[model samples]
Target: MDNGSFALMQQLEQLYIDHHSWLSSLLRRKLSNSSDAADLAHDVYLNLIRKGGVPSAENCRRHLTQIAKGMVIDLYRRRRLEAIHLEALREQPEPLVPSEEVRALAVEALSHVDAALRNQPSKARQALLMHKLSGMGHRDIAAELKVSVSSVEKYIASGLRACTPYAVKRRPFR
Candidate 1:
């Protein structure tokens, strides 16, 4: 390896020894996957090398943590986009081609929430579930529920609040 590359590798080895577990656990608490944490930690090391490597362990740790957190947020945002895209795809007979496996997981999450809402009796719940699973608009749901459009919107918002946390928790979904 080139001298610079070798030096960076050595620094990364030291970083892995010092803070890897801490970084992974921190990421897991705040983010989704341990694999994500490990990948981001490696990215932190790569960024450090690209920036000529930070001098102090304290600075490096802080920098790495910041990068890792940013990566976590970015990943979450991407997943959210994938979910939106997945819903939009269902409008078409053809499926949206997913570059990531998590897209299926996202669809399954929507399915789970839909299944849960099926047992609830509120017309509001039904309206919201129809919008979510069938891609119905507020006006459409309002017509079906015989409610005002604004009421349909409110139902959808409330339903999301009820469902989002539960959806986020059930991981490795089948």
Candidate 2:
């Protein structure tokens, strides 16, 4: 390995050795679970390694804490999203409920769709959802959205193109 890379690795190792236990303790107190705390602590170092800059010794603890806090927020966000998805599933009729695998796929697809729509205009997102999810015709969507039929088509096309990369292909269920 190159000298600089080797030096960075050594610094990271020292940082891990110095702060791991304290970070884990802090995470444990916040998370209320030893295993989750340990995992998150490990992830913090991994993030730092990926980021490739060593903090000054004086600021190391503060830097690590900030990274850990961001990780915790991301973890909480995922958990909250999963809870919301589960609650929505629970509200569906029993016969309409999907298998676990299907549900997972659906949730993943929905996440991608949501992300793709995030930067889109509100009317475009609404038009796309109405057409795809509600099975509304272009003309109906245009009427509902108070736009021209051609505008509805354009919006739907734009949204679909944005999400096309994330589309799940059909496969026979095992």
Candidate 3:
């Protein structure tokens, strides 16, 4: 259609062809895996596709570099989350055969909290959900649940202690 838009697309395409390998090589040196770095470099192009159009070639290189960097940070976050989940799973009583069992454990934990809420009359269960499932801070949960900050802390601590026995226990040391 327009020369400006056409030029922009061409610039991004050429940038991908020229510097994608360079980006992967640099990212691989910094990260643990070359494939992951290549994937991130590829994601930068996919994101531009989603945005309807890429910027002019003059800016596309810089923008691609920025996008690649952000993707690296995102990968780190995902890795951290996976570590936390795996650590938690190791101490739980859930099934180990199927991969879906881990998701089931998360579901069961939420269900236990829900049942406790229905059983309790006051702010305890609500506080538990806010602190555990909703990711609220102690002070924030207290404010939302109309309890003291100390009470919120107590609720979370007690809940965790109460669930520890029910949690998945690790196997004996070899």
Candidate 4:
């Protein structure tokens, strides 16, 4: 690695040595789970390493806290998505139940879709899910969202656009 990168790594290593425990303790209190806190603390450092920057000493705690908070939010969202997927699976008939591999892939895809929708407005996300997942028409979604049909259309379009990057190419089945 170049000198700048090497120096940054050294700084990060020192930072980790200095503050990992404090960060983990802080997260543990917030999450009320030692293991999750530890995992998120590690993720904070990993994210910093990925970004290839060491925060100033005075700002290190703030930076780490921000990363940890975001990670915790993502963890909660992922867990909720997984739980919802599992519940849906439980409702299927045994004969039509997906294989474990398929179930895993489905959950992963759902997480991707959730992540893609994370930044959309709440109404847009709700409208898209109601229309796509519940097979609700635009009028129905508009009624449920208490908006005009044109608004529902715009909301669904906004959600779909947010998810476009995560969309997989599909092939026609034989």
- Pick the lDDT winner: 4
Can you give the TM-score per candidate against the true fold?
0.47, 0.66, 0.51, 0.70
Candidate 4, poorest ten consecutive residues by summed lDDT: 165-174
The digit string of per-residue lDDT tens for model 2 on 18-117 reads 9899999999999999999999999999988888988999999999999999888867866777788889999999987778998798778867766787
Candidate number with greatest TM-score: 4
Q: Write the per-residue lDDT of candidate 4 for residues 62-137, one digit (tens) a residue.
A: 9888988899999998998899879999999998787898788777777888888877899999999998889999
Clashing pairs in 2: none
For model 2, the stretches where C-alpha displacement exceeds 4 angstroms are 109-164, 167-174
lDDT of 4 at 73: 91
lDDT, candidates in the order shown? 0.71, 0.89, 0.70, 0.89
Ranking by TM-score: 4, 2, 3, 1
Prediction 2 TM-score vs. true? 0.66
Q: How far is candidate 2 from the true structure (C-alpha RMSD, Å)?
A: 7.1
- For each candidate, C-alpha RMSD in Å? 14.8, 7.1, 11.6, 4.8
Off by over 4 Å in 1: 50-52, 93-174
Task: Kindly list the per-residue Cα lDDT of model 1 for residues 96-154, writing each as its tens digit.
Answer: 34435655666666566654554455986887768877999889889999989998888
Quote model 3's TM-score: 0.51
Model 4 stretches with alpha carbons more than 4 Å out: 116-174
Q: Candidate 2 local accuracy as lDDT? A: 0.89
